[model samples]
Target: MISTQKSFEKKEQGSLYLVPTPIGNLDDMTFRAIQILKEVDYIASEDTRNTQKLLNHFDISTSQLSYHEHNTNERTPQLIEKMLNGQSVAQVSDAGMPSISDPGVELVKAAIESGITVVPLPGPNAALTALIASGLTPQPFYFYGFLPRKKKDLVASLVDLNKREETLVFYESPHRIKQVVEQMVIVFGAERQIVLAREVTKRFEEFVRGTAPDVLEWLENEQIRGEFVLIVEGNSDIEEEAPQSWESLSLKDHVEELMENQDLPSKKAIKEVAQLRGLQKREVYAAYHEINE
Candidate 1:
């Protein structure tokens, strides 16, 4: 059901405003955003102390409540209740837009379930800022926020992500950029073109563009600092290889062939064959182990 309400004109309960703050430069803050910050009754901030600086600079004296990941479970209901009682609220992150790899999404969902209005304001974001100048395809892009920290899970995730056909965008910190690119080279191949946009909208802003191997070479000697937005070209040359013939092989032999060819463990290879043949995992397991017995 698509329900539309005339924002700022309808007379009812309070609204939830999602305001965007400047990513780095203070000058990027819009005038209307400043007015909304001042006009709202209370602000739900990711970091109250960090938001105070932005508030103090514009001389906006709105009260704030800490609403980060750690406190969202307890704070979301309180914020929703306050809005239900007709107290206007504005949600903000430490920087950039609220709920983009941030903590405002739960609160927004809570508010909507309770029938409170949500009003989102458009403004600065790190990913799009870097992408427009990245010289990569902007449309049909995938904005995959921070990659997983663990190497195994990260590699597995990248293995699945490597098949995507659209340009991929990601946010990465300085410390992991080099290692992350190295891993990308393994999954996506060394010749895949990638771009790193660093410290956007700030004084030392930079855009580094090259193949994955080329960037890995640059990171060897230079000191890495600042946050990063990575743009990678899609796999346009994905080869259409023919599937291996399983017609002549029995169930046990097919599982063995997959284990050797795909470098999969017995259990994993059995599961793969089951999925490929629309058979149950237990059935494949039984067939494979029967030969071993």
Candidate 2:
């Protein structure tokens, strides 16, 4: 029979701590995260070299084991075994909070399934930092971790998001930021408000706020650098209508007005008017059909 003494000792020692490291600035590391890293029996890291640098900076001498996307499947079970063997452990990503567009979710899930005590410590996050300073509507925002790299998928995703009335936040690498911004011009319209933040919480922190087309043009003139956090303004209450001259005109005439004024498609024009009038697309279609009928 198993000894009750060993079980009680295991319960006391086995616990999992999730720690957040700074994203760009070293100063963003929290006191609690530092303390946990120092005290934990072992630390799991996305990149041992990167975590070593942070550890050295903070004077944390805790042992580290590599646990990232490449090795997570193989390493996770072993790590859980160690925890089960009565060892307090901590997990950290290269930067920012673990399991947040990072590689700690699976490990956390494993620990939970094993009935290990899991704890999370607060720290720096790039997306939230950029969102607060974006000068856009803050409440009811959507965090879309990263946009698709391919053009077709990216445009489709943006189109889908265009239907939502909440601010959208996304991360984009420096190389893709300009292309993403240009596509945003097509999908969300040239004049939709956008805020581009770079090097957040670092020495080179910068926020550029303007219309999509304007920002796209500005990016073209300058060299894009550093990690980027993009925030797009959602649909506004103020409806941008076709010119008044087209109000009393035919459906075909209205389409022409939109083409001249907004350079939009016939279907898009109809949809815009339908939204403004609080009617269905088919209702607008029927009016157009009757007009031509």
Model 1 lDDT at residue 50 = 97
In order, candidate lDDTs are: 0.91, 0.86
lDDT (Cα) of model 2: 0.86
| TM-scores for all predictions | 0.85, 0.77
Kindly list the per-residue Cα lDDT of model 2 for residues 50-149, writing each as its tens digit.
9999999999999999999989889999999998988888999988889888899999888878778788787899988899999998889999988898
Writing each residue's lDDT as its tens digit, candidate 1 over 1-293 gives 87665667764578899999999999999998999999989999999999999999999999999999998899998988888888999999998999998889999888888888889999999999998998888888999999999999889988878888889999999999998998999999988999999999999999999999998898887799999999999878877767669967888999999989989899899998899889988888989989443
- For model 1, the stretches where C-alpha displacement exceeds 4 angstroms are 1-4, 241-276, 280-293
In the order shown, the candidates' Cα RMSDs to the true structure are 5.4, 10.0
- Residue 213 error, candidate 1, Å: 1.0
Tell me the deviation in Å of residue 278 in model 1.
3.4
Winning model by lDDT: 1
How does candidate 2 fare on TM-score? 0.77
